[model samples]
Target: MMNRRDFLKLACFSVVGTPARSVFDRLTGKDIAGPTKEGQPKWAMVVDLKMCASKPGCRDCVDACHSIHNVPAFNNPKDEVKWVWTDSYKNIFPEQSHRFVSVEVQTRPVLILCNHCENPPCVKVCPTRATFRREDGIVMMDYHRCIGCRYCMAACPYGARSFNWKDPRPFIKKIKEDFPTRTKGVVEKCSFCEERLAKGLKPACVEACTTKALTFGDLNEPNSQVRNLLASKPNIRRKAYLGTEPKVFYLE
Candidate 1:
């Protein structure tokens, strides 16, 4: 990891010389912007529809994820901020759509969030290196380094990135002290609770689910819950044809 002094020297604005990086990325530290590290667990989430359907009015997963991440709610659909939310099956999986598909299946909503794609378009278009994939395959956003260019937002096909049009703190009903609240202009989204993972805990959404609707674990381990669930269920990704290789899957 680069120390503060090294980062300052590398990223600091120079009057006479060309800048090596944007003042932001350099100030925020370069290591977080780098490639995946070796031997780290690749995290993935599986949404099981059977259990999800059992809890009709349950918004526990969304609430837990947002509360823990300090995600704000502007309430307007145009400026809505959500790390996890409900989406209709047809909208999420248009490729699989067919005439007169079961009414119940069509109407049933599914959880949607960042896929944390293996080939993340958001990471590719980020000029400031604000968005990068971690060693464990979790795509992260460094809010401090973000320039709010919205290039990553345009690049993302999953509609996962949310830009704060206003300071989000005031809109947050209940704040999580340990979690950092994003300021206006930085893009934010589901991090898969990298903070909790570091402390040997599961993501808040997964832990809060009463019906065990959400399953998360390392994809590398063959016996892991995520992998086992995948093997046991015929699952589908949001856009598997695009080749982004989204880590999130849905079983309906």
Candidate 2:
């Protein structure tokens, strides 16, 4: 017997032919067609590891991102909900390291978040179209449409998305009224601070960094700081060989 979710999924695929507009747009109330034209401002971020390392044990970026987004602080590893956090260099860029790599570089703490890849596999695997990429290239999730199928979580190589094991509002120390708190049985992740971008402000993490290690701007703009940094610095992306084309670049 087809369950409600199964019926919806089948109905969505049935209504839309292979090449038509996303059937889930009407069904899920969100557009799945992403980045149709050229020259639109494609958002990206650059993280300078040297500068970030200068301020060792800095949690400004992580705290700022989580507070503004209303991310829960479950404190349990099993129910962790993180928008931004840190990981060791080798863990972040396993393919970029070698035996000759300096120990300092290998174990350096690097900020981690959704890379907002140009070709996001999560969007492709989301059965309910809960996850989709915007025309500006920001991968977003509609929590309401999410059926907690966990397919997107399995598809994302970066492990950026988090599944809410329980209602998250209670765990949030203080809810940001502007952002909606997510319920149990949904997936969420960094949206590249699209809300702040819409308000002509930078991402929470970038603005909160005292060392100015994080840079955010339009990747399509030749004169943008992010573009200029990428041009002048040797940068690496997490799991780039997977062909994700991650917009977040780390200058090591």
Taking the tens digit of each residue's C-alpha lDDT, what string does model 1 give over 1-252?
999998787665464234545555555444343554566688999999878988887899898888878888898988888899988788888888877899788768888999998878788778987899877889999999999999998988999989998899999989989988889988999999889899999998899999989999999888899999999979999988887889999888
TM-score of each: 0.84, 0.86
Off by over 4 Å in 2: 1-39
In the predicted model 1, the residue pairs found to clash are none
Candidate 1: C-alpha lDDT = 0.86
Q: How large an RMSD does model 1 have?
A: 9.7
Write down the lDDT of every candidate, Cα atoms only. Answer: 0.86, 0.88
Model 1 segments more than 4 A misplaced: 1-38
In model 1, the Cα lDDT at residue 166 comes to 89
The window of 10 residues in a row where model 1 has the poorest summed lDDT is 24-33
- Residues 50-92 of candidate 2 have per-residue lDDT tens digits of 8999988899999999998999999889999988999998888
